[model samples]
Target: METTPTEKKSIKNFFAKLGPGLVTGASDDDPSGIATYSQAGAQFGVKLLWTALLTYPLMVSIQEMCARIGLVTNHGLTGIIKRNYSKPVLYIIVLVSYPSITLNIGADIAGMGAVGNLLLPGIPSFIFSLGFTALLMFGIIFFNYNKIAAILKWLCICLFSYIIIPFLSKTNWGAVLQATIIPSFEISKAYFMALVGILGTTISPYLFFWQTSMEVEEVRQKKLIVDKAVIHGMQTDVKGGMLLTNIVFFFIILTSGTVLFNAGIHNIDTVEEAAKALQPLAGNMAYALFSIGVIGTGLLAIPVLAGASSYMMAEVFDWEEGLDKKFHEAKGFYITIIISLIIGLLIQFLGISPVQALLWSAVLYGITAPVMIAIILHICNNKKIMGTYTNNRISNVLGFATLLLMLAAAIALIWFLLK
Candidate 1:
């Protein structure tokens, strides 16, 4: 079955249209996300697999709104808030966002380093962490936006490894189908906590900033006019990206649920642990693929995390900023990125547990997500800001639904934490 030229051209065209959305979606399943999904599958089996299905449309709606905001205003989410909203509002948003995003970066870097060490025992994990940090810094500062984006785009293939891992294991397709389509419920604090973490991970504020800014960057680099066609393309890219994200998520859960849970290996705390556990149970191939995927996703995600923070800071302070520009041209932006990576790397040496760091980050994300979603909805609906690009009725419905859902998740998380 050889592909014809027409099929090849269509496939190429599909990938060509996948810019910001594709990369963004791929980045969402970072090491931290992999760990979360792994934990869910290991601890609860396929009970939570339905979340992957549930979050798809919600994610698409929110991301589409963010992309639309970026296309219309030519500014990142932070910039839009800074311009139209009050000073304290913007400051509060930034204040809550930095720690969480930085902590997430740290956890991911640590996960990557741990997995690197797992792959090759001779090298110390910190050495691998340092090497990766330096590699990311070099690439981000030295490479232009187009090259870096292409690298990230290609890195998306790493997620396919996860998709393949499930098939390597003896997965029960009927059980997986039942878990995916039929929603499951549990009345426990831990269940709700995991649910909150998954929600926070999937629909994050940092992603909102990144998506909006990347769309602006896309338009500027290509000089694409913001019209119906452009908006439609952005929507398509976002939908494709989010669909990819959820599919990878589902498969990861399926792999762990079928392999680890059935083997009585529950409670996976880290990506490395998940991989190591897979080796003896599911075989070496599963372990190797999972470990490799962690590193690849780290490469893809760390930049997005650092870049999101940098973009937010640059936008708030009105500094010259862009991944498209040279480091010298956007010193503040590049400096913020470097500082984020540095802090993230240093966090591992501070004796903080990666699990605790991830937990706190999830908590912060839960807090900020609802507020940001509300603000985004307000911005997208405000005629003064969006003009004709204001969200349609369907968009508004989905947008508000996402807001209420996150708000509920946040409240539930807080209640459980205090309990």
Candidate 2:
């Protein structure tokens, strides 16, 4: 079939409008995400392969709502919530989410340095962590929003190595296909824990705040005033980005299932563990490729973790925020980001296990996520705030379902821990 000129132009314009979603999706596969997926592949093999498929729609729907909220209101989530709800509500969210997100930033920075050390042996992880932190702080503080967006988009390409490396391995396509299609699982504590980790990593809370804030930033970048038409386009961009995100997630599990699962290596505590285990079955190239992906994702995720916290704090206090402004213009925003990086670097020097820290942060995020979702759902549906843009029945159903599932997961995790 021949394509029409209009269709071609539409495609061109679509690519041109892609920004927030792509970055959000790419950052979804950060170092912590890599560890979670790798652990899933190693421990359960393909048993939990269905999770990536199951979580896709939920991820898209929730993120789309967030993007929509930001676009329609032209305010960050915190700012919107602060206006709609009581001070107690706002304080509770900021207090819980701020520390949890900052801790996640520390974990990601630590992971980034650890992965960097893997790529460049003999270099200290602490040095790499501090150096990377400084670089990120400087980049975000000095660079304009356009430059930061460009850098992030380019960094997303590093994820392609996962796609390439999996193919190089001697994979059993037949088994991979079967595992992906059939959602089989072993009934055990370990398997259950891995499932929680997978869910926590995939359907994360940070992505929610980051995605919405980025949508506002996107509109600001294009100088588009917030209105119905603009919000509609922003929602479209978000959906497109989420679709790309889930597709990459599907492949991450597929690659891990084929390479890590097939090798009978059931324990993977870190990204490096997954990489090392793939050496015999996937060859040296596989290790190198996986390491590269981790490095790229680490770079992408750390900034987001730090930035999201900064956005939350700045919004709560009515301080200027957004990369679109200069340091003098957004002093509080820039300072929040710097403090986050500094604290994160300082944590690396505390002799804590980075992997363990990442795991605890994931658990904390799981616990805090439900509260944020509740506030988001409530605020988004408020007629006075959202006008006709309030979530429709379908959106509410999906959003509520996500909230319930996250709450359940948190409870289950706590129960499991106590036992």
Candidate 3:
């Protein structure tokens, strides 16, 4: 069973290639996403497992395009939009993104705090939320981008906790496999809403901003030349990250589908609820591991939510920005991030539950996703911008499909709300 030197080198090279893409994709499975996937499984069992399969390609295609745009343009998505698109368009994108990103930050912070309190019953959740926010702010402000990126890479290991949960309980592998391969559906408004939620969570505007900005950072930090080999490496990283993301997504749903649905606990509204429900059914180990994952994902995601929003503001206003820069060097950028964290933390004090925050964030995400996707598609395909690195035929096909899917999901979400 021992690997040869060639195999060892291959594995090492694979990991070395994984950078911004890995962090970006791993952060996608934040506490909000955990709640969504858990709710899907609890309500419909393995019937919705195929969503993981459905979203993988779409996620990879869209994110790869974003990464490529960053590499080619040497600018963040917001800056690109500001330069190429109209002022109103840029403002609208920023306006929609601000609340959505902040809401997500608040929800993630609350989820982590609640899970932290679950681990230690004596502590108040709000106290834990405040402490985490402070710690994140300190690290982001003091530590350089390289250090933060390394920590984010390490945090991705936490997602493996969910992969182990389903195994702790009894799982019908046959049914799980069938559900994953063969899609199923129901004709209920709730089902559609859940479907939309999953889509919106997976293919989000915040992630688009984060991915592009991080790629720009990666290029600048490493001084990487954007050639064919570099592009291929980025593609590999994005594929690996997104593939890992969907795997985690698949297992979370599988765990809740088999464990909670079978136990008749169908309403999972939050990450803490999902973790707590597993304790009696799947044992304390499962509960503890799930709780740990929630906290870890919150750590991984909140910075991304706050940073993505900050980067947008910086790029739009031409403020000196980068995690690599010192506090004095990019005061506006760091201040925006600090302010975002503070505002997001304050949101928890407004009597809003994490689930409610997620719902509100989801609404904004749905409204803006289609517009963002359309813009990304336009950018990736525009020869004048991408130059020689324009999206190929397959990329265009997948990109357009993603755009259509999000558009339809947005319209459906609106219809559901109206009803």
Q: Which regions in candidate 3 have their CA more than 4 angstroms from the true location?
A: none
TM-score for each predicted model, relative to the true structure: 0.98, 0.94, 0.99
Task: Report the lDDT of model 3 for residue 192.
Answer: 95
Evaluation by lDDT, superior candidate among 1 and 3: 3
The candidate 2 region of ten consecutive residues with least summed lDDT is 243-252
Model 1: residues >4 Å from true position, as ranges?
1-6
Q: Each candidate's lDDT (Cα)?
A: 0.93, 0.80, 0.94
* Residues 1-419 of candidate 1: C-alpha lDDT, one tens digit per residue: 99999999989887788999999999999999999999989988999999998899999999999999999999999999999989999999999999999999999999999999999999999999999999999999999999999999999999999999988878889988999999999998878878888898899888999999999999899999899989988988999999999999888988988999999998999999999999999899989999999999999999999999999999999999999999889999999999999999999999987888898999999999999999999999999999999989998888889999999999998898898
lDDT for 350 (candidate 2): 81
lDDT score for residue 298 of model 2: 76
Better of 2 and 3 by lDDT: 3
Question: Mind giving the per-residue lDDT tens digits that candidate 3 earns over 266-330?
Answer: 99998889988999999999999999999899899888999999999999999999999999999
Highest-lDDT candidate: 3
Among the numbered candidates, top TM-score falls to 3
Candidate rank order under TM-score: 3, 1, 2
Model 1 residue pairs with clashes: none
Q: Alpha carbon lDDT of residue 113, candidate 2?
A: 78
Q: How close is candidate 2 to the true structure, as a TM-score?
A: 0.94
